[model samples]
Target chain A: MIAVLGLVVGVVAGLLVRPEVPAAVEPYLPIAVVAALDAVFGGLRAMLDGIFDDKVFVVSFLSNVVVAALIVFLGDKLGVGAQLSTGVVVVLGIRIFSNAAAIRRHVFRA
Target chain B: MSDHDRTNGHRFRAELPAEVTAPPSAAEETPGERTPAALTGRQRLVKGLWPPRVTRAQLIVALLLFGLGFGLAVQVASNSDGDSALRGARQEDLVRILDELDDRTQRLEDEKQGLEKQRGELENSSDQAEEARKQTVEKERQLGVLAGTVAAQGPGITMTVQDTKGRVEADMLLDAVQELRAAGAEAIQVNGVRVVAGTFLTDSGDTVSVDGNKINAPYRFKVIGKPQDLEPALNIPGGVVQTLEKELATVTVERSSKIVVDALRAAERPDYARSSSR
Candidate 1:
């Protein structure tokens, strides 16, 4: 519940302040956002399973965004940035679907 | 290890009883609780990924989840509001948009071409009107020269009358001037005085006055016309030279290649002489 409250507050603050991302880092924002989404789903599933670890969630969330951006940056150097971004999105999307399914089962008990 | 050993191990695990295969509950107090060694590989795998414990870890996990949710919201907002909407568009949508833009450009180019054609036609019509105006101005200049309101120069004849007997009258000079006019004289001057349509001559007793200017004996007349026609007109039998010679005056006519008639008259602006349509 506190986590949900923090999310709402952060969103409101972000909207009000409207922080501008630097031009150099702008290319990575979409990928980082997708990675952050994967971490949120994983965290939700963990919370539902009664094994929600704050340290693990924070570490995983930070690592997911960083690693996703790093992969794209490296792919750009290799001239495969688009393909790498697609691969990352596909993997993260599958994970999100599975975690969402688990959360649904826990909530509905079906 | 190998595929065969893995298959055999899976088969043995499948043969275990339901009670032996059940997961160990940490909270349950039972006498026949299974040891950690009795846990299956699947159970261990699940435990590694998700630890069923509520502790300080929840705080860190919750904070990170909050951050993730915030980032997601911000990303969504920025993506919708930013200038790079094409980055999120599908390939087919981008192609359709490009086609529409090309069509619009082609239409604009055609419109511009049409306007350019119209401008060209307008310029052509204006050029024709200017040419016509120049021709009219040239016609007016020729008319002004003939009417004696403008100066004129051309091949013609000059005549001089030496009336040693003082018998030459203004009427006789007037007759000579009329004869030149009938023979198509473009311009004429008598004794430094211009001759025009409104010119009047009078006998001034031993002199002739043309347009209120008196000219003495040795009356020289400069006439501008076709030299062939003017010289023949003066030499015609019973013409002005013959009549003037009978009056005891020596008349001489000479043809010249260039004769100047520098005379100007102000054009009349008649308030009552408006042109009728007929």
Candidate 2:
């Protein structure tokens, strides 16, 4: 439930800062997914360590998502959505690799 | 942690740090001590990532997250039940607009051809039908006046847009005005009212009201700016006309030699959008 409550950190923040997007932004959906999953993985790690502090997790999750989104938005504003999304995938790709390694150890260790 | 483990009739060995590996059986055991494998922080990290089996904590967190996500989805879903209605309205508006554009575009083209013929006549022969001549001159005056009003500069530009079907919306108007402002327009007026942050949108089933004024066509707008600055405001890509070309709305812009935009009253605030910090 705590992890569940933690996900609101993104949704509420999303509605707060996410502008009413037009259909043109459909392509950036994947970047948003990566950012969300990154937050989830990071949150689960925090919970297991007995450090599931709401403020830290929520703020961290929100900022992480927003910063990624904002960069894309800025790129969109600057007419560079495709390039910015590519930039996002590069950083998120590295984070995904690191996070997957962590998840592997978490589940398989005896 | 153990150097060798026997599991399911197979022996497996691991290379681990001294703290992580179990001590030799000959070593004296400490009283009330944790297992040797528990000594390494890295092992704990590995264990947290992929335990051999699921833990109660993981189940609780997953269930909780799903429930919360569902509840939020439901809440937002209920509130936006107007999506269908909005879509319907938008479609209806679009159909009406296309028809109007078809008719108006043809009319404008015909008018342009007529004006051209009139010009050709003046060049070829001076004498023309007086009544036809007067009517053409009147239209020219209106267009000229409006163009001049947009060109003049004291404050801003007012663009009055309306649809015969009463379908022009505040959002549409807002978008156009925003574009104009973005194009360096100092200020703007729509339907004789000033554009300000507090400007609101209200619907009386047909016409959408702006700033509490029951404005209808012929939507006359006046602007105060250099003709050069204001004209470009209306021509940018994806600008005013594109946004507001809804089916039931007809937009006619006139720039007058001396356009008067009445000082407007403060508009009411919208309740739907709230401040982020608040």
Candidate 3:
């Protein structure tokens, strides 16, 4: 219950603050967001499986964002940024879908 | 009984004999015996998912998700804001804007090509001074045509404004000249008076004066430019033709293969300014 409330509060604060993203980091933001979403879904799945670990969740979330941004940065340096970002989004999107499916089954049994 | 014992055997692994011998009610009351594997798969899944385990890890994950959602929302909002004007524009307006942009690009491309050609000629010619001199003369002739100091003939339009009611004013005639100039008029003449860069018009009683040279109706405008562009420019909706007609004046615009503006202005010597180029 407290966790859900924390999420709501974070979202409200973000919306109200509306911070300007730095231009240097703007290109990586979408990739980072996708990576974060994947981590979130993975965490939800782990919680449902009764294997939720605070340390594991925090580390995975941070690593996911960092690695995703790093890949895009490297791709940009290599001049394959667009293709690499597409690949990253596609892979993350698949994971999010599968995790969502698992959550749905846990909640609805259908 | 045997099947029940076999399925429930894993549930009572530590206290198998005690659980077998104990009362069923007492066995059911113990929380430790409710192992997930002991229940059916569906029931186990439900049990694992339900009664909301709000762990610290889950709270952190939620916070991260909140950040992700906020970023997504802002990105979406900003992207929409950038194209909102284009999105709201009508199809025709959008097409017209695109056409205008294309026309501008084409004009720029033509200018670039022309400049490149000039540079190529200057570079490839033997005796570069003679080539430069020739180009200078050609440029001077073009400038002279524009300055109305030399006569010009071209495929252009002839506009005759007959103002029987004399409602046509100097400003209206000035508007026509401006419209023609905007339509790429290279040279213009009204009643044998040359219209140049410094030409001005003023109301002189019942007639109009072009550079103080009084000209009466029908004001015949011999304009040297592309006939196609100049004619339509004058005849466009709410344009020069419509404005002139509203004044009870008769306006006739005719496209011709050749139009001549022979009216000349004297090349005046500069009193204060001279060419600064070496």
Which predicted model would earn the best DockQ? 1
lDDT of 2 by residue, A41-91 (tens): 655544332244444544555566567778877877786666877899788
Q: Provide the lowest-lDDT 10-residue window in model 1 chain A.
A: A45-54
Model 1: lDDT to the true structure: 0.74
Model 3: per-residue lDDT, tens digit, B50-140? 6677766556666766677777665555445674556433345677899999999999999999999998987777568878899999998
Sort by lDDT, best first.
3, 1, 2
Where is the poorest 10-residue window by lDDT in model 3 chain A?
A: A44-53
TM-score, cand. 3 vs. native: 0.40
Better of 1 and 3 by DockQ: 1
On the 0 to 100 scale, the lDDT of residue A89 in model 2 is: 75
Candidate 1 Cα misplacement greater than 4 A, ranges: A1-38, A41-50, A53-110, B1-89
Decreasing DockQ order of the candidates? 1, 3, 2
Candidate 2 residues B81-118, lDDT tens each? 57633432233356777899999999999999999999
Fnat, one value per model = 0.26, 0.07, 0.26
Off by over 4 Å in 2: A4-30, A47-53, B1-278
Error of 1 at A90 (Å): 17
| Candidate closest to the true structure, highest lDDT | 3
